[model samples]
Target: MKQVTPFLMFEGKAEEAMTFYCETIPDSSVLDVTRYGSGEGGPEGTVKLARVSISGLEVMVYNSPVHHAFTFTPSVSLYVDCSTEAELNGIVEALAKDGKFLMPLDNYGFSRRFAWLNDRFGVSWQINLA
Candidate 1:
């Protein structure tokens, strides 16, 4: 297991988001899924949380009805290092669909190809080809 895991809070969309994530990543699987109504400690009749694993990376997603209290920020982002330009471009293009592009794909000083964008779910990602 990894030492540190990313926990994402969703607004009544934990199941949907987790399903989408699992489908997007190759060989990804849902390790465990516990619904609120099924658990004694969780809120009644709601999806409290879910655990999804993608390529051995564990991610937790929880449905928190309180949306106003928290907002997704660019301060934290996932950076994917690609070995080839084609791989980087594919990731960038896929993530950019129905998403906001912070910087168009271009060459940077450190990398031959780079791009930053926030996916449809509001999670930001930085794709770079070294």
Candidate 2:
């Protein structure tokens, strides 16, 4: 295979999520974005497709035109290996705002500082201090 990338489907929050992730993570940015125009499948001005680079990983985000009963689950998640405690804390706090934590920031045997949470947009994430 040439490459594999993680895909995130958002009903209408793709752009917002991309912005939040890029701002929260150090050395991250939005690489590209395709917005839906008039007559497009998704609502006008909504994200048709977007590529966000978080640290170094490229993640794909899309705004789905059709509503679905399902959404992001904790079974799968974006994992982050933080190099500093400050970075870890900042990320955890930003992601946890208006979100629920599956495992709060604490030592979990494997890592000294670890946090697992579903962000406000329903995307799951695991933050760890390396």
Candidate 3:
């Protein structure tokens, strides 16, 4: 069977992002981190590969050896189905520290509450209460 997982690529903040996610999100964990050794072109000890689980969903995280021309955009976002208002609000506060919200958490005829924002790592997230 074929398996698919969401992959997150970072210029150099993969490790930090992975750690942050694990801390900020409930039931999240970071595991199997492999660092780049010297002369691998990436900064030594940077995250070359890692697996992160957020709310039991797998995510492949890695630091790029080369700088990309572009970063993440709001076009593609990770949608989270929060079970409670507290969960949704907690995630919103944690991710909003260094980020800006595209749409503040509010009822927009779609759901009771929703928030769209790009995190500090430039990754977009859409959290909702359902």
Candidate 4:
């Protein structure tokens, strides 16, 4: 309970998505990664747990062994406040590839521009230009 970190559960792409986020976002990094051992429920070398940061916002991710009927939804989303349109747009473009956009980038009056989507790994995100 030291901190409330956002946790993402990927079916089998936790490591790949973590690496993508680290590379796509500025000032972001992967703090740690722990993988399942050989013959474990998960494939060897698959991420058991991983800690990563985007814009210094620390988040957790892991691969789940059990299948579920549910997945990420726009109802709950990670909201990012960007300093510039370029910053917001850059992230939106990278994330938009192979991702579904809940709301395409537009001036929603509340913000200069905004885009909401569930990223390639099925994590919801809402980016806004302040």
Candidate 5:
């Protein structure tokens, strides 16, 4: 089957961010972590790319200091559909570290979920358990 995954770009915190994410999400794991210097077209010790999986969903994370002409905005976000309130809360809490919340975690008329700020790395996520 064809899969669509979210790709995240970090200035210089790809490794650290991936590690943190893996620790936060249950059954989440990181695949290959490639360094720049280890191959062509990257600086030494810097992460070139990494494949991470959370609940079987794959996400790509990369480190690119050269902004060139790209930037991250809140226009797009990843929505996580959780199975339980506890799982949803765990994700919200974990992603909230050093991150601000746009909306407080609470129960809405439609669903019980939390939507909030991007993490310290500026990645926005929506956690929902319906």
Candidate 6:
């Protein structure tokens, strides 16, 4: 009720994902991080919790101690509004590496250029040029 933010659950790749995202996106960075220590629920040095600002959007990242059968799905995705075509192209290329694309980059009628894909971390993203 107070506030709402997107939460990303990763098996053990939370830190990697955060770093990748911060590096790939402009004006993005890791705001804070809490790592697991000895005797903690998760593996030592792993990301117990992390807050990252991706292109001005604050998101929560966690390394879940328990593994599940499910993972990130295309139904829910991080939508990006790009300022330039070059930015869109760069982001799409970086995210699409070792990942699957649900919608390839093109003028999809709704936008000048757009692309929907799951990053290597399995997180879905929709990049658009407005």
Report lDDT per candidate. Answer: 0.77, 0.95, 0.91, 0.88, 0.80, 0.96
Model 2 over residues 39-103: C-alpha lDDT tens digits?
98888888899999999999999999999999989999999999999999999999999999999
TM of each candidate vs. truth: 0.79, 0.97, 0.94, 0.94, 0.83, 0.97
- Reference-based lDDT, residue 109, model 2: 99
The candidate, 1 or 2, that scores higher on TM-score is: 2
| Superposition error at 19 for model 4 (Å) | 1.0
What would you estimate as the lDDT of candidate 3?
A: 0.91
**Candidate 6: deviation at residue 40, Å?**
0.9
Ranking by lDDT: 6, 2, 3, 4, 5, 1
User: Where does the lowest 10-residue lDDT sum fall in candidate 4?
Assistant: 65-74
Candidate 6's TM-score reads 0.97
58-123: candidate 4 lDDT, tens digit per residue: 999989987889888788888888888888889999999999999899988988799999998788
lDDT of 1 by residue, 1-130 (tens): 6388899888777777778767654567888877776445546776687788865778888888665676577788877777777767777877888889887898777776889888888888888886
Q: Any idea what lDDT model 5 has? A: 0.80
Write down the worst ten-residue block by lDDT for model 2.
Answer: 39-48
Lowest lDDT block of 10, candidate 6: 103-112
Clashes of each: 0, 0, 0, 0, 1, 0
Instruction: Please report how far candidate 4 places residue 41 from its true position, in Å.
Output: 0.6
User: lDDT per residue, candidate 3, 37-76, as tens digits?
Assistant: 9999888888899999987989999899898899999999
Better of 2 and 4 by TM-score: 2
Candidate 6 regions off by >4 Å?
none
Candidate 5 colliding pairs? 102-117
